[model samples]
Structure formats: C-alpha cells, structure tokens
Target chain A: MTHEAKTVSEQTRERLLDAAREAFSQHGFQGATVREICRRAEANVAAVNYHFGNKDGLLAEALNFAPLKAMQLANAKADGNPEVRLRLFIRDFMLMLLDETNGSLPCRIMARELADPTPALDKIVREAIAPLHDFLGKLLREIAGGKTGEAELRRCMHSILGQCLYYRHSHPVLQRLHPKLRYDHKKIETIAEHIADFSLAGIGYISGKTCA
Target chain B: MTHEAKTVSEQTRERLLDAAREAFSQHGFQGATVREICRRAEANVAAVNYHFGNKDGLLAEALNFAPLKAMQLANAKADGNPEVRLRLFIRDFMLMLLDETNGSLPCRIMARELADPTPALDKIVREAIAPLHDFLGKLLREIAGGKTGEAELRRCMHSILGQCLYYRHSHPVLQRLHPKLRYDHKKIETIAEHIADFSLAGIGYISGKTCA
Candidate 1:
C-alpha cells in the first residue's frame, strides 16, 4: 500500500512537470502563470505550490529534466579515451538539440532565463548541468593534459555547442535565407554532420596544446 | 541643403533604430512596448509608427539593419573566392557579435527569435537576409562550379553563424559551470577565435559536389 501511494505521487509529479514545461516554454517564466499550469495538469491550484513552491520552482523542475537526461546519455558514451568521450558528448548534445521542436520554444525560454536568469536557473545548473560540465571539463582536461587554459577549453566547448545549436535557434533566419530548405530533412542531416566535423577541428586544436 | 536634410533624417532613423535595438535586446519583443521604445528614443509613439508602422514592423526594421550592414562589410572583404568570402563573413560576424554585447542580453533575444520566429521574424529574413543569401549563394556556386546542392550550403553557413552566436548566448550557463570565469574578457576573446577556426574548418569541406 505504501509502494502504491509512492507510485501515485510519482505519476502526479511527472504529469505536473510535463505540463509545466509546455506552459513555460510557450509563455515564458514571467508570462506563465501557476494557474495555467494547474489547469493543464488538471490538478489543484495549490498542487504546483505544494509540489514546486512557486512558478520559478516549477520552471526549474521542468528545465532541469532535459539536462539530467542529456548528461546521463552523454556520460554513458564516455569511452576509455577522453577525446572520444568529448566527441560523443558533442554528438549526443547535437542529437538532443535536433530532437527538439521546430520553434525550440523550450530552449528559447531557457535562453531568456539565462539573460536575466532568476535564482531558479542556478538550481538547474547546480543540480542538472554541473555534472555534465564537470564530465566535459575532465574529459577536455585529460585530452589537453591539463595544459589548455580553462578559458580556452570553455570557449572551444561553447563554440562546438553554438555550431550544433545554430540551426534550431536561427531556424527563422535560415528559413528566410534558404526558403526552399526550411524543413528539408536532408538539409538538417547535412548541417548536423557538417557542424560536428568543424567543431572537432577547433576542439582538437585546443587538445593539441598539450604537445605545444 | 538637400544633403543636410537627408543627414538629419538619417540621424533620427539611426536613433530610433538604436533605441529599438536596446529595448528589444533588454525586454524582448513581447515584453517591450512601443511606449518604452519611444521613451528610450526620446521620440514620440507617432514617430515610431510613421517610420516603421506597428510594433511588429518596428521589430522587423530593427532586425533588418544589422545583418544588412554586416553583409555590406563582409562583401567588402569578398575576393571572388567563395571560400575566402565565407571566412571573411564568419570572422566579421563573430567580431560584430562580440562587439554588440556586454552581458549578452542581445544575444539572448536574438537566439530566442531564431529558436521561435514569428511574423516579425519574416520581415527580418525576407527584406534583410535574402540579399545576403543571394550574395553568398552566388559566391558558393562560383567555387563549387555550380554543382553543390542548395541544402548542403545552407547547413554549412548556418553552422558557421551558430558557432559564433552560441558562445555569447550560453555565456551565463558557462559562468555557472566555471564559477571563476564569469564575464571574463579573455574568455570571450578565446571563444571568438575558436568559433572562427572551427567554422572555417567546416566551411572548408565545400568541395562543390553533392556527396554522401
């Protein structure tokens, strides 16, 4: 009976989170009301407050889910070699990014939060993303033999991400620029592989510093 | 005196644009009202409507200015070789992105628009980016002997822009990951270089033929 109660609670929590992600992604944090999330979840108004304490808490709860899932996937791709692990990390991240929606409202909401990140952003970073960063950093450090400057490694990693994420974020502009290729599956596939190849060139340069 | 009148009109237009850019960067399209923009510009609401029509029109106008200007700058560096022109474009784009922000609010807003473009996004792309595309496409065709697939080139170019833009967009997330490097100038510089180097490698893969 105790186990049944726990399972029910878990299911409720998951439902709330899914609803919150959709709500926050569409309306953004400031615009997304707790009442709306409750309505979407078909739960009580106080339920979100009970489960997450506030809108910010709910947003954090939803946002943290992806990073945690992504990190787990990324970490599992860790081969014996740090370089290989880092490469896998990049690939996994790109794939995760591609799996996102057309408008990428979730990532956009997250981007907005970063600009004026509330305290909630910190919690997500601490709990979900920090582990991924550490994993990537350690892998990069091993590849660099601790010789690459921290700033350089951060820049290289961020560039790799930026390249991968560009298509999702700038779909609107790219759509206009290349109208014929907006939803072309072949185009997206080419972009993914192309970005991966280029990012490797830049990241490998940083690792090469160990020899220099 | 005709030239003098043109100068004054240009100056006012520039001021309105500057104000729009500032407001849009800080508050985003949804959050920023025309009153705020007018107040920031020290111009009247009527002035905004006269120059750019509705709020959406104003946003389109604001988005149009930078990329067009950027293309002009990049085209100046064009040396008949598409590869060289592309490298120049990436380098110039990165420099402009770096110069345009401090804490990256602009980067955040731009990233959001890319992720989830709307009607306003259309004007920016159609009026502004279309020319840039034509210019780039012709250059690429020249290099590829008019043989590369349209989708392949689009992906490569998008990847280049993404690498440049992502570094600033994710700066805050990165800061939290490496707490000690928050807002570090050296870090931004390093990212610019990394993006340039990496994207160059990706663009370098343009052998002109549709392959794999």
Candidate 2:
C-alpha cells in the first residue's frame, strides 16, 4: 500500500478505537455493537473486523487504550514526607476516578467491567489494579514504620482505597443523599484531604504510634 | 376466590417473587426476563403480568424483598459507648454485605442498579441508603463529640462505609490481588474490626481529638 493509503488506514483504526472506547464505556462490552461503533467512527461496516480481528479484540485494545500512567507518575514523585506522598497519591487517584475533563473513559469502563465482568477483567487486574495496589501497599508500609502486620497494612490500604472508590461506585446514591455534593476540583481536593488525613490517623493509630 | 384457591394463588405469587429476586440479583433488571422468571418459578408465562403487573413492577417488589432490617437491629442495640456502637455497626454492615448464607441478593441487585440504574434507584436511595446514611451520620457525630462539621462527618461516614462496601464492590479484583483473601465469617470479623479501628482513628483525628 502507498503511504497515503496506509495513513488513511491508520486513521480509520484510530477512529474505531476512539468510538469503541466511548461505546464500551457507555454500553459495556456486551451491550455495544460493531455496527454502532462503526457508525460513530464513520468507518466502513467491516472496519472493526478488519482492524481488530473481532469485537473481543477491539474490546481488549479499547480497555488498554488509556494507560494508567498517572499512578506511575504519582509513585515517582515519592520524594518528600510519607504523609505528603500519601496525600498526593490520594489526590491523584481521586482525580483519576472523579475527573471528567480528564476523560473518565477508563474508570467508567472499569465500572462496567465490575458490574458485569468479561474475560477482559483478568488482564485489567494484572495490568492496572495490581500495580495500583502494590504502589499503595508500599506507601502504607512506609507510613506505618514497618511495625504494622502485613494483613493490617493490607486492610488499611483497602480502607483508603474504599474511601476513594466509593465516590465513583456510588455516585448516584450519593447524589440523592447529598444533592449538592459535586465532584468538582474543589470538592475533589476536599475529599482527597479528608481521605488523606483520615487514613494517616487510622494508620498511625493501628500502628500504635498516634494513640500511644 | 375460595380460601384454598387464594392460598394456592398466594403460594404462586411467593414463588414468582423468589424467582424474580434470584433472577434480578444474577442478571439485573434489564437482563432478566419475565419468561425466565416464570420458568424458574414453574408458573405460567403470563403470571408476571397477572401477579406483579409488569417487569418493572416485579423489579420494584423484588428490590424491596429484603428490608435491610439488620441495620435497624444493629442500630437499636446501640446502648453504651459510641465507639463500640460504631464497631458493631460496621460489623453488622459488613456481614450484610459479605455473608453468602445471609442471601446477598439485595447487595447484588443494588450493585446492578449502581451499574445500570433504572428509575427504581430513587426509591432505593430513599428507602434503604438514606436511612443507613443517617444512622451512620448520627453515630459519627456522637463519636466526634459534636465538634466535627456536618460535611466532615459525612465524609467520615462515607470513609467507613467505603471500607465496608469495598469488600463487596471489588471482590473480584481483591481476590485476584490476594489469592488467599476470603470473606468467610472469621475474615469478615477481622475486616469489620479493621474498618472500625481505622475509621475511629480517622474520625478522632479529623475531629481534633486523637492528635491533640
């Protein structure tokens, strides 16, 4: 194929991926259709099959389209006090989960996966969640001064994460309960601060450092 | 209708509801079919309409089948210390979420609603979640010695709840991350304790008690 043809083909593939991400985020893997994705992408009906082999192939690619590099960036900035690191980490993680302008496609897709898991969940766990878990575990271990038991550390880590994810998973219920609770940048910052302070104190207490 | 015929009709209605709860829990409201529900209940295909009016009506009833009376019971047992009440509340809440023998139908159905919500969400929020939220809020306020701001107290309540609900929402991912992790009776108790301790410290810190 000529250079121009190849470029056109690549553009079509990219459009298909973009359309797939939006469709999958909205309708999930099972609910989304190749015809709809193709229509949204303005590509030929066969474009999905031609580019990604099948719908499953497209889903796999779409699920990984947005890498969670923010987590890695947050971890790399682990230079200062552990408390500061923890706070920054919660802020960044919450932003990823709550921010819309940052394109909440990944989080929404993951929520769909959680609601009705497909075979893609295994890869998602290995690629995205496990790394996040390990990163938080290391940070919590440092904050706890290595004195807390492994199981306790894991629970603490989960407590912190649960606090973060609750905002996302239960967004609808929360809105009803607190009609004015918006996840704007300011509110996100406040929530991040709350989780950070709450978690730091929790860790300190469990490690027998604060209460002692 | 004769007494014996009315008794048989009531039994059929009960069976249909049982089938609906199971189907809605497993397949969600949208995914579950009246035909399938009737098949499971060994009733006529038209029974869903005759008994419950429609699929939506059936969904509404099935959603309310289990009344979350455990939370009410737990709250009523709140007699002595605020901290102990909070711990017992967390324990009861987590048991309701994680206990399989307790029939996780309500939790699973709620999870489905969160994933792909219908109009029934409003009722759920009002009937089930709001009461739970209010109960936890009052407990947190007492624990914080009435010094914590309402906003802060709400976040604290969310933190504790987030910790408990995480075990349910992220069960699949958690299992993948820690293969040995189980939500058995003993493990649930341990987790309940961890969340209670962690959250108490968080509340104490945020309310300016523990750190000072």
Candidate 3:
C-alpha cells in the first residue's frame, strides 16, 4: 500500500489496541466483544479481523502492549550502583504499577489475567515478566555479593517484588485498610524508599553483609 | 419452623455457599450466574434468595467465607514466643492460601475480587482483612519491641504479608518461572520458614534489634 495508507492502518491498529485494553480490563477476555471494541475504537467491524486476524489475536497484542513499553522505560538507565539501581528499579516499577493517568489499563488487565488466566499468560510471563525477574535477580545478586544461595536469592527477589506488587494487586484492600493511604506520586516515592530500605536490610541480613 | 426443617434449611445454605464460592471463584462476581450456582448446589431456584437474599448477597457471603474461616485457624494459638508465632502465622496463612484440596476456592475468589472489586470488598476488608491486619500489626509490634514507628510497622507488615500473598496472587507466573516448583506440604513449610526468617531480619534491622 501507499505511505498514507500504511500510516492510516497503523493508526487504526493503535486505536484498536487502546480500545481492546480498556474492554479487556473492564469485561475480561471472554466477556469482551469484538463489535463493542470496534465501536469504541471508531473503526469498521472488519478492521479488527483485518488487522489482528481475530479477537484472540487482538487480545494477545493488547496484553503484550503495555509491559513492553514499560520495560523499555525501566531498562533505560542501569548504570548506577546496585543499591541505587535497586531503589530506582523499585521507584520506576511502583510508578508503572500505580500509574493512573492511563486509566491503569495495564495493571487492571494484568489483575484480570491473574484472576482468570488465558493461554496468553505463558507468553506474557516468558516475554515480559521473566526478563524483569532476571533483571531484578541480577541486581539482587550484585547486592548480595554473590554469596547467597540460589533458593535464598530467588526468595529475596520475590520479597522485593511482592512488596512492590502488593500496592497494585491489593490496592482496593490497601485503601480500605488505610483510608488515608493513597498512591499519589509522593506516596509512591515513600513506598519505593520503604521497600528498597526494607529489602536491602533483609538481603544484608541474609547475605551476611552490612547494608551500607 | 420445626427443628428438622431448620436443619434442612441450614444444609441447603451450606450447599449454596459451597456452590457460590466455586462459581464466583471461576467466573468472578459479574460473570457468575445465580442459575448456574443453584444448578451446582442442586437447590431450588429460589433457594439463593431464601438463603442469601440475591446474587449480590451471595457474592458478599461467598467472598467473606474463606478468609474468616482461615482467620479462626490462624488465631487459634497465640501464646507462643513472638518469633514462633510469626512462623506459625506464616505457615497457616500460606497453607490457607495454597490449599489446593479445596480447589483453592478462597484464593481464587479473592484474586477475582482484587481484579474486579465489588461493594463486597469493603466488608471483606473490614470484617476479615482488617482484624487480621491488626493481629499481624500487634505481633509485629511485639517483635519490634514497640520501637518501630507506626508507618514503619505498617510497611513491615505489608512486606511480610506481601511475600506470603505473592505466592498465591502470582501463582501462574511463579509456576511458569519455575515449572518444577510445587506447593506440597514440605514446600509450604520451607517457604514459611524463609519468609518468617527474612521478615524477622527485616523487622529487626529496621527496629534496631538483632534477630536472635
């Protein structure tokens, strides 16, 4: 096709993805309909089939969309000390997980996946989560000074990530438990610092190192 | 009514609750149907109304069922050393969260609620989660020797609970990441020990105590 045609097709694809994410987030995969997604995207009914091959295809694309983008942003700077890197990683991760400006579509969709997993979950874990896990594990190993056992290191990684994820996954419960607690930008920073410090101490205690 | 009739009615209610928990766990609140739930329970169509009032009421009851039951088990013995209490708490909590024999209905339903919260969540948090939080918070305070600040104490609680809950909330991801890892009785014990030890060190480090 011509350049203008290609650009229009690309725009339509992006719009469909945006609409798909919102629908999937709200209604889940089995509950969301292609016609409604098309209506929300303002695209022709055939657009989804033509661009994504089918609704499942669209769902896969939408599920893969946000984390890859966030990954790019998270992996952008890795030059700091492991401690600083851990803090930055926690801050960026909390920000990504708690971001509401984009309607939290990523987190909402992910929460849905956790609740009712589809075949797409394996791909997500392999492509998005596994890399992030590796990144965190490496940083953790650096901080632990390479003496921690594989199992302990893995558990420590889970501890750090579990702390970060609780804010997003149990957000409704958190708000109710602490009525004043909000994930405003400032609160996110505070949470990031707290997780980082607690994790560093936990690691230090495990790895026989004093947290400097 | 008569005593025998009351006994039959109570049996029907128990059946409905079991069916409701299974349906809501699989399909979420909005996706689960009263008809399907009745069918599963092998009860009269109007039994849900007579038992729990409506679908929303059923959802509320089903959502509140497991955690409260688990709380009783967790709180059954609280007279031990604070450290032993923490280990037992983590063990029981993990067991409740990872119990596959019950089809993991409690954790699955809880995950669904987290993904798509209804009005029932506030009740769950207040009636079930808040008391548990207070219980853990008080235990954490004892471990910290009453020296940790309130905010720090709360974060520490989140950190500890987050570690335990992550194994449930992120089970699919965890499975994919470590396909060989399984939550048998022994594995749960190991995880409990790790989290208890890690958390004790964290609390100790933060509260200026040496983990004995």
Candidate 4:
C-alpha cells in the first residue's frame, strides 16, 4: 500500500510481464505453462497468482504495457503535416511492435485470440488496444477529406497493422523460404516506410474519392 | 472409374469440403470436431474419413477450394499491366474472403491457423496458397521494376497480403470499435483501392530509392 511497496510490486510485475512476452510469443498461450513463466521470471509461481492471478490474466496484463506505451508515444509525436504525423505514427507503431522487451508475442497471441477469441480478449481490447484504435481512427478522420467511411478506415488500419506485423510474425517461415531476410534496423525501417506510404496513399485516394 | 462416377465422387467431396470449411473456420482445427462437421454437412462421420482421411486432411482440402478458384478467375483475366491485374486480384481476393457460401468461419479458421501455423501449413501453402503468394510477389517485382532484392520482394508481397487479409481477419474487432464500419461490397472495393495504391506507391518508392 505504501509507495515503496508499490514500486517493489511494480518491478516484480514488470519482470513477470517480460517473461510472459517471450514465452507466449514463442509457444503461444495454450502452449505456454505457468511453471515456465515462473522459471523465466525467477519469481515464485505463486507470485504470478499473487500479482495477476492466472495465466490468461498475466498474458492480458503483459500485452497492455508495450502497445499502450507505444500508442502514447505515437500520439505524443503528432507533428508536421497530417501525412507526416501519420507516417511517424506508423513508424512508431512498427517499432513498438518489435519491442523485444515485449517481443512479437503480443501480436501473435492477440492475432490468434482474434481468430478464436477468449474472454481475456475483452480486457485486451478494452484496456490495452482500444486507445490505439481510437488514435488511428481519429488521425484517419482528420486526414480523410470526408471521403472515408468507417469500414474503409478500419480496413485501412487493419491493412497497415497487418503488413507491419506480418514480417516479424511470419519470420520463421519467411526465413524457411529464403535465408536472407533478417530482422534488423534497416529491413524494419524499409518495411515500415513501405507500409506507411502504401497505407497513406490509399487513405489519400480514398479520402479524395469519398468512398473509402 | 467412369466419368459419371468421378463426377459424383467429386460432388460428394465438394459437399464434405463445404462442411469442413464452415466447421474449421468457425471453430479452428483443434477446436473443431469431426462429429460436428458431419452433422452440419448432413453426411455420416464415415463420409468425412472416407473423403478427406481425417480432420486435418479435411481442413487442407477445404482451404484449397474457393480462393484458388476465385484467384484463377482473377488471374485468367490478367492483363498487360500486372498492377492493373493486381488491382483486380485484390478485389477478387476480398470477395473470396467474403465468400458467404462458407460464412465468416473460414476467415476465422485461416486467421487462427496463420497465427499458430500447424503441420497443415505446408499443404495449405503448397496446394492452396503458394501460387497466390508467388503471383502477388511477381506483380510487386514488376512494379518494383524487377530490381528489388529477393527477400525485399517477398517481404513486400507479405506486407500487401497481410494488409488485405488482415482486414477480413480482424473484421470482428474493428467492427465493434467503429460500429460504423461494415464489410459491404462498396466499402470492400474502396479499401482494396486504398491498399493497392498504398502498396503500389510504397513499392515504387522503395524500389526506386533503395535500388538507386
């Protein structure tokens, strides 16, 4: 309850989250076990129960940190022309997605959950992800030029996010097909720019045309 | 066998595929059961085993239909301009995603499968998916002036495909957030245009700039 206790508890929770990010991303939720998470965290198995209560709860809590923090950063860096700001946001978002501190597990797990969502999905959307959705939709609306519809906008963001995340999520298989595509700074930036430009151009045309 | 017998067998197999598509798409591979598929198809459980060998086999066969057939239709009408043909391909691909004959279940199943790809992935990729991927990647290459790196071209194709498919795959969540968004024909076409333009511009810019 005291400030010191809160800080200590928070650090412990952060460690658990760090471990969850790695485990869930690698093995997936159903495949990830609590014992393994505890081992990675170097904390008591009861610590997870004590901190977040269950595996699903921990997973949900863990996913919240990176995207939420990134969305905050993306919104904060709103600058230049509408197009420029949107580009920066896309860049930041892709960078956030690759936050190895959190890893690509959140994306993999969140995506899997979307296909066959569980109850924890409500918490993820409500707490961690909805703000990013709102932020993007609002940005799209401002730049939309009155030509965009809600569905088109959603699809637009979905497209951008999907393209951004696909390389990392599919890295294993992509490398299987070709050995050269490494996940590093230059490649990530190239892909990020492509997605933003492609997405924004689509938005520009859609907004100009009045149907998207 | 006689031609008539082969035709009848094909129809029976089609009926089984319809059932598997719905079941697998709705419940995912592990989540879906053979009994439920038979119940839906109005065929005996024995028919499923007889037709596809098992649940996994049924899923693979089911995924092979619809999209490939529709993609063939798109490719058949391919034109001198790969970009223009690509625009059409994106349109048909969206329609395939909306293949109401199977409902949204196939979308869900495929999304989940991609999230946690199974042993079934290679077959799904080889029989049903690789051609489309290869086709799209080649279009990107032509658009990129055919000078892009192999890994870069593959990544580019992956990005475009991810964006297009992610719209349908993530529709449920996006719809809830925007309540205003709908996946109707007009809207789908609009988003497709946006994706095509966005991707085209990005590919052009990166290929030109990076290659130069």
* Model 1 accuracy (lDDT, Cα): 0.63
Clashing residue pairs found in predicted model 1: A169-B114, A169-B115
Candidate lDDT (C-alpha), each:
0.63, 0.81, 0.78, 0.69
Error of 2 at B44 (Å): 4.0
TM-scores of all candidate predictions against the true structure? 0.75, 0.89, 0.84, 0.78
Among the numbered candidates, top DockQ falls to 2
Best by lDDT: 2
Candidate 3 docking quality: incorrect, acceptable, medium or high: medium
Residue B28 shift from truth in candidate 1, angstroms: 1.2
Local accuracy of candidate 2 as per-residue lDDT tens digits, A12-57: 9989988998998777787788999999999988889889888888
Error of 3 at B179 (Å): 3.2
Candidate 1 or 4, higher DockQ? 1
List per-model TM-scores for chain B.
Answer: 0.66, 0.86, 0.81, 0.80
Tell me the tens digit of each residue's lDDT in model 1 across B1-212: 76445676577777887788788775667767888888888887798888887887777667645554656665766686665665666555555555544433333455556555556666556554566556656665555454566756665556666666675566577667666864345544555556656555445555422442
Runs of candidate 3 with Cα error greater than 4 angstroms are A1-7, A23-39, A44-47, A64-77, A101-108, A209-212, B1-9, B31-36, B43-50, B63-77, B101-108, B145-147, B209-212
Clash pairs detected, candidate 4: A25-A105, A147-A210, A149-A212, A151-B181, A198-B198, B25-B105
- Per-candidate DockQ values are 0.48, 0.70, 0.56, 0.40
Query: Per-residue lDDT for A22-42 in model 4, tens only?
Result: 887676676678989889988
Q: Cα RMSD to native, each candidate?
A: 5.0, 3.1, 4.1, 4.4
Number of colliding residue pairs in each model: 2, 0, 0, 6
The candidate, 1 or 3, that scores higher on DockQ is 3
The fraction of correct interface contacts reproduced by each prediction comes to 0.70, 0.76, 0.56, 0.42
List interface RMSDs for the candidates, in order. 2.7, 1.5, 1.8, 2.7
